[model samples]
Target: MKKLILVRHAKSSWEHQVTDHERPLNERGFQDANLVSNNLNLDGLKPDLILCSDSVRTITTASIFTSNLNIDESKVIFKPELYDFTGGNLVNAIKNCDDTVGSIMLFGHNHAITSFVNTYGHIYIDNVPTCGVVVIGFLINKWKDLNKGKTIKTVFPRDLRSSIHSR
Candidate 1:
């Protein structure tokens, strides 16, 4: 069996006049990630490995959760391919994942993360908001042979009552 945890990069800052990949998470993004991490820890959601996007925002988002979990640094991999916003790109990263690992948490851009869960998971998610956590389980032993299995759960930042209402 395999478990895939998909997390969309947290809300990033546009205040910085930098490239998209260089953008960092905003203040709320950090708070959201911390809140979601605390919840995930309470839920006992731990992964054998984590595949993270090498971009600034994605990496920072992943770090927050991993730090809370105290996941070994060796278990986290920053892949350049995950920096994309295409489902195919995310799937490619999954396909290349080490078969020995039973569960993996992937942090990346949305549309891709949202589309991936919608495409492979049994449930329908209209959108995977920033810092959203979507868990899906596959019955297959090998990650490469993974297909539609089941939708385990989705933990949205707002669902945790951490939504930031606009003024």
Candidate 2:
């Protein structure tokens, strides 16, 4: 079985005059990233590979999860192709992933992230909010044979934040 975990980048700052690719995460983004990552229960679903968009916001969000989850930094591969907003490039990237990898965690932008999850995962999430994580499990042995899979779990910042407030 192959497991695929999708993560959307945290809220980016619009205060900068830089291009979209260079925009960093804002204060709320940092908090949400840390909160969600720290609260995640991986349940032994350690990723063999981490595919991340090279954009600043995505990279920073990935960094927070890797650090919080204690995942090795070496496992992360920055892919400029993953910066794509459309799901096409994102689909190609996942399909092209090495078969040797049993599991993959991807960090990317919206539309692509949300679209992929909706198409591939069983759950119909209207939106995968910033710093949100959706874990899907595929029954196929090869990445190339990927098809509609079960949505194993989801860790959204809002869900975690709501629990915290209720406590």
Candidate 3:
């Protein structure tokens, strides 16, 4: 079984006049990233590889999850191609991954993330919000063989907020 975890980068700040690629995460982004990552139940499944977009917002979001999960920084690969919002490059990047990897965690932008999940996963999601996580499981062994798979779990900051605050 192969597991793929898709995480949308945290909410980005528009206050800066920097280019889109250089936009940093907003304050809410940091909080949401921490909340969602801390709430995930990995069930002993850890990512063998982490593919992250080279953009600043994506990197910051991925870094928070990595820190919370105790994932080694060495496992991460910042790919410029993953910055795509179209999902085409995202699909290609995933399909081209080494066959040796059983699980992969990808940090990217949407509608690519949302579109990919709805297309590949069994469940249909309206949107994958910032700092949202969707875990998908495929029956195939090789990355190239990835097909329609199960939507195992979804962790969104909005959902967590209510539950956390209630408790």
Candidate 4:
């Protein structure tokens, strides 16, 4: 099974007088990113490759999680095309990944992230919150064989909280 992990960039700061691409993560975003990493750690889900948007916020969010998780930074690849808001672009970008990668983590903006998850998954998640992480499992052995309704896991920050509460 191929695992595709989708991570939405953490909340950005509007206080900075810069373009959307240059905006950095806010304090709340930092905390939320840490929460996301912690949840992933508890879930024992690790990715072999991390494909992230070149935007500052997305980059920062990826960095925070990888650092906290003690994941090697060299595994990450920053791509400008991931900044796209449409699901088609995101799908194309994912389909282009090296097939050797068994598990991949993608960090980017939404509605692209949301649309991509909803398109491929059957779950009815209303919104993918900032720093949210969703894990989708594909049945095919190769990335080229990816298709809709192949997801096996859909994890989110709130789901983690709820699971912890129930436990």
Q: After superposition, how far is residue 29 of candidate 4 from its true place, in Å?
A: 0.3
User: How many clashing pairs per prediction, in order?
Assistant: 0, 0, 0, 0
On TM-score, the stronger of 1 and 3 is 3
TM-score of 4: 0.89
TM-score of each model, in listed order? 0.93, 0.99, 0.98, 0.89
| Candidate 2 per-residue C-alpha lDDT over 6-58 given as tens digits, one digit per residue, 9 for 90 to 100 | 99999999999999999999999999999989998989788999999999999
2 or 3: which has the higher lDDT? 3
lDDT of 4: 0.84
Candidate whose lDDT is highest: 3
Off by over 4 Å in 2: none
The lDDT, on a scale of 0 to 1, for candidate 2 is 0.95
Indicate the TM-score of model 1. Answer: 0.93
Sort all candidates by lDDT, best to worst. Answer: 3, 2, 1, 4
**Which digits, one per residue and each the tens of the lDDT, describe model 4 over residues 1-167?**
78888899989999989999999999988878887787675267668899999999999999998898888999999989888988777788788888889889899999998888888877867778888877788877777778875556555666666777899
For model 2, state the Cα shift of residue 116 in Å.
Answer: 0.4
Q: Write down the worst ten-residue block by lDDT for model 2.
A: 37-46
Residue 107 of model 3 has an lDDT of 99
Superposed by TM-score, candidate 1 places the C-alpha of residue 125 at a distance from the truth, in angstroms, of 0.4
